[model samples]
Target: MKRTVLAIDIGSTKICALIAEIDDDNNAQIIGAGIAKAQGLRKGSITNIELASKSIKSALNDAKRVAGTELRSAIVTISGAYTKSLNSSGIVNIPNKEITLNEIQRVMHTSLYNANIPNEFEVLHALPYNFKVDDQDFIEDPLGMNAARLEVETHIITTQKSNLNNLRKAVKAAGVEVESVVLSGYASAIAVLNADEKELGAAVVDMGGNTSNIVIHSGHAIRYNDFLGVGSNHITNDLSMALHTPLHTADNVKITYGSLYAPSNDLIELPVIGDETSSHEVSLEVVHNVIYARVEETLMIIAQSIEKSGLKEHMGAGVVLTGGFTKIEGLRELAVAILDNMPVRLAKPTDVGGLFDTLRDPSYSGAVGLIKYLADGYTAYEIDVNRRMRHAGEESATHTGSLPEEAPKFEPIAPASSTPTSAAPTPPVKDEKIAESATMVNIGSNKPVQDDQPNPISKFWNWATQLF
Candidate 1:
């Protein structure tokens, strides 16, 4: 079957849709995209469902037109000032000497058993960061390993229940069912950060238009998360008021000539867009000051939050920054000035196949990473079906006794057939057994291919994607 995944990124300013085809080998290639001005949402949460629904449907229709295929379900991204996160731990005794997949599931469930989510909040994700087997610490995957007792620590994310429902309803109203909701910060990290940055302990700051999301990671998992209400839009407002110009005019000034860490001593002339005939002689210096002030304030608040995380001391890998606001020239320079302990670098989504060149903006990081997230979670067990079908499978898994097994080696997913193969002749029974035990080989070089992600990240993302 040809599997397609529609990933949507919903922000206060815009909505982005990316569609990719998942091939037999489980590799995903981008095939289509849609971007539309966002509506009915303020600072990431929906206020007007009807308008939001219209915006979503418009974006998806554009994406479907480009893809030449209609998809009814999408895995969407959601964020807001309303989001919250915390850490929790759980312990359990193993009945068997060796751990089994089912036992792993049971312990993970026990970890969240007493997690005290607030009444108005609902769990978005419970990501396991650490695992212990008896006296041994930091056991990444204990399955098939001998252990008497198991312990786990998880990072739990939650958002307002009402907000989640309204967003879900808005997407459903658009005629596209919501497949799953991922926290915007984690999705951005998946798209931008490299394995070394993640494993060596680095903080990723996604500075979007209406909100800036800060995540601290150490020991190969996200340890802390913080959301800042002020963002680039705040800077635009400051510019607007300082220059006596309209908001749209200020936004244009920021995009055209904004600088965060530059000297404002230089002079220039800028005619307000509406009053082009009456040009105002202004120093780039004045524009620089207005932008620098707000951006610096935002950066300082983020640095303080990092200090509070206490992961600041361990951030030897420094900071990796992304999101549209990061595009502002000299933002990294300002960040470097504020965060003296480590260097700050700009990043965007990398290593994605197919539509890599088109989805190059840091703004698209969340959407692209969501594809990687969903693709990495792909297994033989999941069906390429609609939202209702997927929900049923998940419900059945919860009610069933056993958890799904790890991916087994199979014959190189045969080339996507040009003709219907559903009723094609079956392969020889012996060939099937050989394929199961064989290492996947590259066609040209005949070398076995393996996943590039450090095994630990792959395992955790696998479990977390399914669990959420």
Candidate 2:
């Protein structure tokens, strides 16, 4: 069956909505998209629920109109400004002497429960970045393994409950339910980072209109996240103040003439503030100076954030820059210089089928990432508190001591290969005795494949590849 998914990204400058069709293979094909000028938001935080709701509604209406379908629920992006993160570890004994899904889930939950998150914050994502079984380290999937002890290290992301509540209220007022909330920085990282980058470690900076989101991805998950209240809009504001031009006119000038490198002596005409009939000429050098100052300061802070994360040494892949602010000319080169000579690359969402022309921009990375997150099942390892509560209720009613007959299967963390698979049927395991003694488990599959199963090693290898 085909599944329809909707993703919404609400930012300081704009609100975007995306609708896509997800295939059985978990590929997303964009069907429609909508963008509207953002209101009631400052520095990525909602200031007025009514105005924000209207903006969300406008974007949703446009997307629904283009797709010719009604969107009832959507995965939404939340700014990193309202989020915080930490790392935690949990260890448990395997009483059965064999690892299973239940043990994995329990270990993860233990880590979360031990975190002692503040009451004012709500957990958004709890990602397991490393696993250990007995004396073995870096065990990608411990399921079906003979182990007396299991350990897991996880990255926990939490958001301010007040801000989260306002975000949900805005979306609810827009007539759509929010299915999930993703950290804006993490979403951007998901949309752009590649397999190698994720494994080697990389920092992603999403420079939006009024805020910049910084996230560090290492060991297959986000290890740290930080936010800056300044962004591209600050440059525009500086131009308006320095040149005495209207805000809109200054923005136009910045887009047309802004650059950190190759500042020219040429002059450009600008409309004076509050005087439509009056115009003034400003030196291109002045415009460049204003933009340079803001960009420099922003990049400097981002560099400091990376250093502050204490994971800078692990960022072998360097920094990946995305978002609308990154579109400024010469930004990547400047980033390299400011980021301690680290490799810097500007990125956008990876290409997809259907109406994806407009969605290709860096500004849409968070929106596009929402669909990818949903299709990829990136939260397979996350502990669902509500589900656990329901299970507890059922257990109390039935007074049962046994585990559930069917456990939720783990999905692969890595992106799927583009190469097509052969039509030949997979051969069954040959050694029944050995298979029962030591079953080889692949995280991507619904069930554990025996050790003698075809390509068992390859399946495990693929599972080791983390999500980018």
Candidate 3:
């Protein structure tokens, strides 16, 4: 039976919900999606439980309606300016002479031992960036390797425990369960980034209402993360101040006339705030300048973050931009100007089943990516189970704990078929076991095949066509 997953992104300006299913081909197909204007959130931090609960409940209901099934649990997104990232090193002595999985796990655990978390913060994710055994380095997996010392460098991500608990309470009160919490920028990366980009190093920027979440990845590992306390809300405020217009009217005018590029005519007009909207015109040039200035500032902040990662020169995939604010006109061009000639592109989620036609916007990337990650994690577990079964049933199964021997060989648990035959077919045993003998030939080839992804092709297209 097909399995279903729910993904939610609790952003500064919106709460998005996505319901998806994994197909036999290992693709995430979206079955439903919901988006609600955010409330009780400031700078990516929950401020009011009542308002946040309402938003969560409304989005969950919308998703359930479209899914035709009730969802009890969901993966949610979290972002805040207070979140910090650091690279820590860990080492462990392998008493058994050989670096085993347990030894690696121990080294990883030791690397994250920090007594500085003020009792109000907890680690959200501990990502192992690289592993080393003895003197060898960059080992992705260290199992079965001959070494006396195992070492690992990990990226530790922590969030305020108080904030997490509040988010948990709000989600639970909305009649849903929180399966896991993922960083907003990381969630976007899971949905839009391909393996090569991840391997070559890229920065994912999630521009939201009041916060921009940044995550850095290189060699398929996250190296740094940071959040800047600025977003499209700054732009709106700038317009409100520059035009001397009310907040509502200023927002509308900015959306209608905002542009990152300067106009040759430099002519613009906006209604003056008076009785019945009296005839008053503001220069389009003024509106454009105000919006562009704030956007440039946001991009500059992101650029500085990239430089601080010490990976500005090694970024092979460049920058990927996603969020509701990215939908504004001329943002891509502005991004290109600020990103130092790197390849800049907007990413959107794809490969949904129901209501997919309406969920193609870049703003939904986080929720969609959460669904895809959940599906991939589930598929990996199923494959592992089948492998174990094959190993246990094989006649020549190796006793070594390094993976199952024969991918879980099967035995006949039932009597012969009802069809009568002149001669009874002998049940294969010992050396006659084809599955046992051929296990080594295809053991490592069981993973679902994924073809190459080209850089020029949009991420959405890559996601949509890869499933086939």
The alpha-carbon RMSD values of the candidates against the true structure, listed in the order shown, are: 14.8, 13.8, 16.8
lDDT of 1 by residue, 74-97 (tens): 898888468887778766555445
Rank ordering of all candidates by lDDT, starting from the highest: 2, 1, 3
Position 112, candidate 3: lDDT: 60
Q: Write one digit per residue (lDDT tens) for candidate 2, span 1-468.
A: 679999999887999999999887677888988899999888888899999999999999999999999978988888887687888987766655778666665677677767869999998888877889988887766768998778988888888999989999999999999877888888888888898898899998889999989888886767888989988889989999999998988899888887789888998888888886899888998988889989999999998888889999999999999998988999989989888899999999877668468888998888887888767735335543121311212222122223333222221222236223421122112222221112123212433445566465566767777532
Q: After superposition, how far is residue 421 of candidate 1 from its true place, in Å?
A: 48
- Least accurate stretch of 10 residues (summed lDDT) in model 3? 378-387
Q: What is the C-alpha lDDT of each candidate?
A: 0.72, 0.78, 0.68
Clashing pairs in 1: 264-285
Identify the candidate with maximal TM-score. Answer: 2
Q: Which runs of model 3 end up more than 4 angstroms from their true locations? A: 23-25, 93-101, 114-116, 143-146, 264-269, 274-276, 350-355, 377-468
Top-lDDT candidate index: 2
Model 1 bad stretches (over 4 Å): 261-279, 377-468
lDDT of 1 at 345: 84
lDDT of 3 by residue, 1-468 (tens): 577888888988889888887665556677777788888878877899889989988888898898888888877888755676667776765544666433443455556653244566666666777888889888865767887667778777778887888888889988888877877877777777877788788888888778888888777777888888988878888887788777788888766776777654555555655542654567787777788788888888899989888987767899988876787788888888888788887877655555476567777777777776665521100011011211111221223243223222222112234223422322212122332223232333333234463233345555767788
lDDT for model 2: 0.78
